[model samples]
Target: MLNVNFYEHIDDTLLKFAVIVSKSNGKWVFCKHRERTTYECPGGHRELEEDIITTAKRELYEETGATTYTLEEVCVYSVSDGINESFGMLFYADITEFGQLPESEIERIELFDQLPDKLTYQDIHPILINKINSFLKVKGILNNIELKDNIIPDISDLIDLYNDVGWSNYTKNIDMLKLAYDNSLRIVSLWDVNKLIGIIRVVGDGYSIIYIQDLIILTEYQKQGLGSMLMNYVLNAYKDVYQKVLLTENQTSTVKFYESCGFVSNDKYNCVAFVQFKM
Candidate 1:
């Protein structure tokens, strides 16, 4: 219910920028500058006549003293801190090439703050942000566009839809989607404004337990923390009605994802599933 575009409302033009995060021993390399006392990712404004990637690289070199490595845009954030009109894009860089820390204009450096910074997407929760996420195939949180609902642009045609395509093979194609879309089921789709980016299907009797099936989100959209958003919606919407929302995920990279979404694994034996396919 807060203003997300706090800067744009007054500035008329939103500011553009970039940031870089360098992971090191035990703590990440961060810098503090200007009036901001909190340590932030290393990067700054995009100079006129500049592109995004280049801005990220220049910022990286200036802050961390790491001149060589690969960088990727992890997430973009609105830099409307309080009344500030500046916007920033947070980049996650894998520093394959390591070097010494350079002397940056910013002096203070801190490591691992327990709480998310002022730069987080939810730092300034724009009213009805959920409506915006529900309508796009790919929506930028930084864009702040609102929407109602959009399953997919051409959902009927896409064959290997889920990032985990192998999972879909276990079930029929139409059945898979149908389960996700079943209004009778409390299944829901996650959209980035109007296009569907991922979906979560809830199955089970409403009383005893509800199983969370298939929280499939695209690889490109994974790190944005949409999974957590989906789970929050489910939990808050049905916390009183449902006693437990259980899910079974494979023991791979997915296990951690589930854990972060408020699932706890047990050391108790006899915890496994059997799917006897009728071959």
Candidate 2:
């Protein structure tokens, strides 16, 4: 059985190739080699220390003769065939034209409405297809969630979103809220067009320790995975930090959500958080 492991960031030196899976007009485009009857996604080994992204485009063109297209990154993945782990970046493309078929090792190209029975990498094709579909669905939704980093938002809009999410205790002191944002190590705000819908703020030295100071999504936007999107954005940005921390009210739903994002209770490390209330 082949095992795959995913990470937020890996040493690029360990990367092997860029695998591009393309679709055109709702049909999948696959490559056929002169020596094989089985079809495969258009991909090739990295050459002469080229960037993985460049390798993706070059391989797609060389194998499928694709000229006009739009490509989007899907993810970075590593597959272990029970011995060695091979790392590669996965990409999605929408090919519009073949232009002219180039002379290469590829024999021909084919389009299919459904996956063909003969695939070069049988165990991997289904996994890549599922990932592509999931990526398309999530990208469709997140396309509207615009994220801005290190930006000073309009205070009025900030207050309004804070109030809309019932964080009125903080919004009540607008200056304090503004000051907190100003002092944050990093801030990522999510907007729907001109409307502010979500905000995530971080504090502490960005290298050694980072704390999620605040993460709020307007009540109307809650439960739509926007929160997860914001959290993921933050995690990806600060993935190298040694200590990532957050404190939230101990609600079952809240705990479950954070746990799903790889967060664990401090109790698991024999630690506890304490706060003092002034009377």
Candidate 3:
């Protein structure tokens, strides 16, 4: 029997290969070798003195003719066949353009919405695909849910979302709420079909600092991991900013949630936070 295991990180030396699960214009990219009839994701063994990432890029370009693309490390994976084991780094790529196929073992490339039944490595490909799907879902890129940037939702939908979460201050003044959204540096809203389900609003100079003005999720979706998804989206968008800040109620659950998202308390920095509100 064959077994596969995944890890967030491992010794770089252990990664002897690199496999890229790629997509172009929302279609899966798979390649067929000149010597085989089955298809597989583009990948190959790491070469002498070549980093795993370099191997992935070389293989992708050679096999699929992917000239323009974005690649991200997904995780490390190992395959064991009772007596021997091998390790590889998994990557996800979004290809934008393709040039002429490089002269290589790959005979042709195909795009599909789903994987073909005849795959080159049946024991390994399915497990790797599942890992990629999970990674995309966590990064808020997959699933039926849609995330919109700076899109102000309908007033009724906004009100319903805030009211469901017991946050009446925003719902009480629809005009002010809309103005707040309009003036913010960025607003990321999450939707389930047409229903507005969650939002993360930011106020900042867009360079040195960004404050999380508000993050709200409809009550029904509270424990569904959508909040972290929204938080991760904003955090990644502002990763280059020097400072990321937020203020929240002094509650245990809320503190824990933010902590899990990589936020540190002011007290840890030996600093205090103050806010003034007009009565």
| Stretch of 10 with least lDDT, candidate 2 | 3-12
True-structure RMSD, every candidate: 17.1, 8.7, 9.6
* Tens-place lDDT digits, model 3, residues 110-130: 999998999989999999988
lDDT of 2 at 177: 86
In model 3, what are the clashing residue pairs, if there are any?
Answer: none
lDDT of 1 at 94: 52
What does the lDDT come to for candidate 1? 0.54
lDDT (Cα, 0-100) at 72 in candidate 3 = 91
Global CA lDDT computed for model 3 = 0.87
Better of 1 and 2 by lDDT: 2
lDDT of 2 at 167: 78
lDDT of 1 by residue, 1-279 (tens): 233321101111333776665554434555666565555567778888777778889888776666667675544445434565455555666565546666657665555523235543344322212222332234445264222232333444233445344565534666656545554346556555555566666666766677775566655566455666677777766676644546565753456455555565644444654555554
For each candidate, the alpha-carbon lDDT, in order, equals 0.54, 0.84, 0.87
Q: What is the lDDT of residue 148 in candidate 2?
A: 89
Lowest lDDT 10-residue stretch of candidate 1: 5-14
* Superposed Cα RMSD, model 3: 9.6
Number of the predicted model whose TM-score against the real structure is largest = 2
